[model samples]
Target: MIPIPRTLGLTPEQVDDLLTTADRAPSRHDNRPWRFHVTSRVIELYSVPERALPVADPDGREQRMACGAALFNLRLALHGHHVRPTVTFFPDRSRPGLLAVIRHGGTREPTPEQTRLLLAIPAQRFDRRPSGATAVPRNEQHGLRRAALDEGAWLHVVHDRPERALLRTLVLRAERLQTADPAFRAELATWSARSGGVPDCLPAGADGQESIEEEPLMALLTSHLTGTVAEIQVGQALQRVLLTATAAGLATTLLRQVVEVPHTREELRRLFSAARPPQAVLRIGWPGAGTPRHGGDVMTTATVP
Candidate 1:
């Protein structure tokens, strides 16, 4: 077992509150594939394999990455409470499910950087419509790229029409293929809210045909394919881009339809040879004028074990 910090001041209830709020960070499919172990002073984030999406994410890459984003949020939540957390990732190889162990290192005022990121959390939503606005401002784009870099990932904006068109076509093809496949369609349909559905299945709002239709751009986030470690890094990078977008008062929605197809995956790899292999695609923009505020709650609360 990992040693716990000795000087924690927050009660177990407070820690639970922080963890619940932090885990509200967006994830693919609302999988919520995370377990928390809260001691007197530290919180450990572990992966819950049962929540993994085997069909779409066979290797559990997206699940782990989503947890990494939660870990980042946990750090931010601690900052909001005026505590500086010391974080360790993958602390024990024997326990591969352990994603992070965060301890209350000491007290410090929230830094300017932390404050900016925290301020952006609530405003960020996954906008699934064509942004009425033009291109994102250059400075904001630069900031987004930097955010990914800081998290050990790179962000490439496809500016040229040819590249963008290729990505768009690939996405459309993947969407068609997934819709056509009986098995894939069955899985998707099962997740939908029928007259009656499994409590653990995908929520109604999360499984609409229109979710992927609103965004056209197919921006990819890639990582080297040699090892699981790279995939985890890519997930963290994806989260950084997301939070940064939120901070800028922008909206983001990931397009998993393209990456779900093996053929399209290969095509995207061929298209973006210089960047790492594409792990996921995201479309970012300002929310539409009449877009409803309701996108469904992606948050859950649990006792720390």
Candidate 2:
């Protein structure tokens, strides 16, 4: 373990670079609900409640997850700088929005694998288009799972035929319920429009009846813990898995509708044998020729190392 430091050693430019990478983290509808406060000792992460999706994520689970993803990116950037990051989740219960505090622990050289993930950061994007017929290889799938494990979370790949079918039904049912809700539709429209994505339109995979049925390489992220802190960890795990897939030249789409609906989320919990609370579901595959709905410019940005 790296020794902890009392104060963060990052300069203003370094801090800006860290936040730039953090800002690129995947979010629900690209709300970018996280904020960072730079103190003399550390960089503090907070969730912007006003930026959260009230209708789709009332409990703020997705917001916290988004923040966690940002935190993970911040950590990875620190690793690239050869600075170990020490993170404290929910440092003060009174200030509930303050999600995490990251201190400059100590110096450590970046590993080759860490460098790979760091380089993969800019290439990560949310591909709402349909994936091609190429399947994710077994070794890459295992690497994805190991990425989650490294972050203290679980990745359940729905390989069994019956389980995959049942998951598809659950996803379709949740999509129907969400599409039927005027409030949900309105909220989704607002964010989609803001993000310059298809306004008032769900992604092909969001209502992905055909994709879910045909694509058997489905997976859901889970955790043995629950509530605020656990959700944050799940977010970190989610981003790690995403970056890992990106590095391996795979495409991924989030099937969050299933977890957004309470009833379906509970059903999914049962589907996974109640081992852990499901945070996010994913459809992973090789890239296709489909046009992307949103572009991730991290690969082009000089902010990330």
Which residue pairs of candidate 1 clash? none
The lDDT of each candidate is 0.65, 0.79
With candidate 1 superimposed using the best TM-score fit, by how many Å does residue 18's alpha carbon deviate from the native? 1.5
Error of 1 at 144 (Å): 0.9
Question: Which candidate should be chosen as best, given TM-score against the real structure?
Answer: 2
Candidate 1: 10-residue stretch with minimal lDDT: 296-305
For every candidate, C-alpha RMSD to the true structure in Å: 6.0, 5.3
lDDT at residue 138 of model 1 (Cα atoms):
81
lDDT of 2 at 160: 88
lDDT of 2 by residue, 77-119 (tens): 9998899999998899899889899987899999998899888
